[model samples]
Target: MAGRFFSVFSRSLNQPFRSRLQGLMNYGLSCCVNALLQSFSATWELVDLLDRWNPVDKYKESVPLQLRKVLLAMQSDQSQPAPHQDFLHCLDRNYIRLHVQQDAVEVFLSILNLIQQQMSDKALAQEIQSLYKVTVETYLQCLECTYIESGTSFLLSLPMHIKESHNSLEDCIRLFFELQELRDRDNCYCERCGEKKPSKQRFRNSRGYTRKLHCKVTFPETLNISEILTAEALSQSYVQSDSQYSLCAVIVHSGDAMFGHYTAYVRHKKDQSWYYADDSNVRQVSWEEVQNTYGGSEREGTAYMLLYRRTPEGKQQEWSSG
Candidate 1:
């Protein structure tokens, strides 16, 4: 009897509320009602004030120079707390603004000078380097996303502190070069389709026991391998009359130490990976050995070499040079 009475009382309380909720939802006024109901709370009032005065950008652009000067000073002296109170008050709104301000030559120079004053603190220099890289990457990404062309060259222009104990901005720049290349190579083309070689058609060829592929870019050399083999291997099972030649070149991708070891075969004309030449013998092997084993005579040009490799998932990949 008590259970039945409670069920009836519950339905009595919920039915009208349920009806009102259904009506509000059907009319698409639920959200408006919710906002009005939430207005009773302080949090909602704060949000309302923020919405009414979206002045974040204004605050950034209007930062007092006196405070900035103090920051520069503190940044220079590691013994001092970098004045965070005034800055942190505007934290969420002013971060982007502060970052942009820091990009200014004057601002950066001030900070740089401050950092120079604390040159004895190797840890501090390393910290600054990390911050510098993060800033550059963040700026680069934002520019790329926004399609802003101007700041793209800023990375090449920024002066950074070099420390013997830490990897500097130069190292990051080199890595960026290699990464930029891989990004450039994200597209692929099928070699079977050809009509005068598309100005950049790719091809595949075999050299000795290895296969190679390449982009049909011209190189600066040629050779006759079998004619010189007696001077090389002493006997000729490994050397064949029709043995194909491969040539490779070292291209420093992005003006960094990371070089593209390009190798490709001349006869069948395919691209290859660098793994074939990455050997103790191969490294010790001279250009003469390269010529005698794979090179063959051509009228006035040099034969190319290509290298091939198996990828982590068992796919074939190739890289070429010279």
Candidate 2:
């Protein structure tokens, strides 16, 4: 069944797929959510999981229920223009207001949290949650003593802080895992020292698996992390088959930090091609077009959130089978 679906999906990509692709109506400044929905549609794994959910009642008020409906409607051959109005209303009812500028990364995290909170099926909810979970172990070493504190936590999307100057996706990712010195006023409280003292903080991958990072920093189309991650970090994880990742989706923000519009460039999974989606219009694009979002220029759209998939090990597979 999966193979058949991929075959059809691939054919659609090669054809006038944009004509069949439905666009969301921007009701009261809904471009942010609309852009996100485009990326969500591209993430077929998420859509498949959402399809398995069966909500008995209270569907109108449930975020996941509304999301599932909207995604399905968007992919359908129906003539309805504004299919995501209910999903937007559902979000508004859940306190994510409309007619306001939103940060894409924050909205993405909120959607994941909503799914974890509102989904009725426990196992399915967990499956959805695990789809983007990034597990890391944070270590805090006391400077005064040798006492070290470690804790394991999970992030649905890793947030990388960006610098003012030019930066690469690989640098930002490595910086996220790099150790930092916390000294003077920024000291941590040490139980052994019974006082605040200088310390070092670092994080490493906890287990072997593929994870997602919604890089807040601007990133190029192709990202190679072979030289970024330290050997120690890679040696600790068995899932580190390859250190290369291809851009699957890019959530773009245009204008200043205070006010902006959001759009997305999503790559079709089966065909490995790019498409740009802005509110109600989507068009086929190339790799050069995707690089335009790297953002070092003025009055141009900048990449606000990035969605990358690990490159598969075998030459025949474009992406990981999982």
Going through the candidates in the order shown, the clash numbers are 38, 0
Q: lDDT of candidate 2?
A: 0.72
Q: Encode model 1's per-residue lDDT on 1-322: one tens digit a residue.
A: 0000000002343434321000001111112111111111111111222233322233332322222332333212132222333432332233323222111223333433433333344454444333223222211111122221112221212332222233322242233332121123332222333211212111111225322222122221322233333332222233343323223322111111121122211111122212112111112234443333222222212222112111223222132211
Model 2 scores a TM of: 0.85
Error of model 2, residue 206, in angstroms: 25
Model 1 misplaced regions, further than 4 Å: 1-67, 72-82, 95-152, 156-172, 179-185, 188-322
Report the C-alpha displacement of residue 209, candidate 2, in angstroms: 36
What lDDT is reached at residue 189 by model 1? Answer: 29
TM-score for all models, in order of appearance: 0.18, 0.85
Question: Where does the lowest 10-residue lDDT sum fall in candidate 2?
Answer: 1-10
Whole-model lDDT for model 1 versus the true structure?
0.24
Residue 269 alpha-carbon offset, candidate 1, angstroms: 58
Worst 10 residues of 1 by lDDT: 1-10
What count of clashes does model 2 give? 0
Question: Each prediction's Cα lDDT score?
Answer: 0.24, 0.72
